[model samples]
Target: MTGAWKKFSAQAGITMSEPVVEQMFGGERDPQRVADERRWFAHEMRASTYWQPDAAVLRAATPRIVVGIGGDSAGQLCDRTSRALAQSLGTEPTTFPGGHTGFVEIPDVFATHLRTVICEG
Candidate 1:
């Protein structure tokens, strides 16, 4: 969890004190919504756990994965679950701007790296 917080701070260029909840959930926090989020987290965790044996996750044989992890609420990548997946893949995890969300915060940087990884890697 601490690592996740640090990751978020580094990627978003903000401190843990920042009130950026809206970045992920759009500031919605109703009871039903919280329950829904919990349910979805469990469901997604189950799904990601299933990928441990996946040929793809296991077959990063020589693949380079540029990780984009948002904050804790960014869903799968933004959680420790993705760290496990990354470890299973045996690749160095690189952080980019944004969390479970895409590179919307800094799309240009993401695009540059994406292109570099595609062409130069």
Candidate 2:
């Protein structure tokens, strides 16, 4: 997944590869945390394969606002998914700077954008 993450980060317009890698594999002494992460990953995989939500119920429960990653994330799968989700939610995804790790990679800008969105709602 290292190569994949690198590709993702590149598309995200961020380059904290060392920190990302360390965060992913650094907990050598924390067996419990590792085990928990494993369980969560398994659960996520299973859920992704089987989970489906009712659209009407989802629409009723969902907020109408959406913000999507801009810049280098263009043409990426995550961007496409974000657009699709916004469409399903009956709104367009507003573009913000950075990508998947934008909150971490560009915290000040991302936080400002987030505040603007939240305040608008």
Candidate 3:
């Protein structure tokens, strides 16, 4: 888990901190819980890697779709993907506060931004 955190921090161009990890996984960080989370993360990673979006369907739904990228996630994988998706849909990504885990890190601010995006959409 520590190694993963370090790798993710480096990739996201963020500093690694124990507090961030604790906040992310909850203070407990129980071995079993961590294992479960890791397994779920692995599954999600694999699923995302292979699941290709249908361009026709995406184009049809483009107007209704809103791509969002975190403010601090520039050059990160999620940021790149969001930008690519928005471009493919002929739109630009909406910038939200904080990094990839903004929703978790700053729920109030993130919620407000999300609401604005949805209302505007």
Measured by TM-score, the strongest candidate is 3
Per-residue lDDT of candidate 3, residues 16-57 (tens digit): 577776686555577987887698567775687567677569
Candidates in order, TM-scores: namely: 0.43, 0.61, 0.74
Model 1 stretches with alpha carbons more than 4 Å out: 1-57, 60-79
Q: TM-score of the candidate numbered 2? A: 0.61
* Descending-TM-score candidate ranking: 3, 2, 1
lDDT at residue 93 of model 1 (Cα atoms): 55
Model 3's TM-score against the true structure: 0.74
Q: Which ten residues in a row have the lowest lDDT in candidate 2?
A: 1-10
lDDT of 2 by residue, 1-121 (tens): 4454455456544466687666775636478866775675556645753554455666787575454756557766567767777777687788887866677879899899888987887
Clashes of each: 3, 0, 0
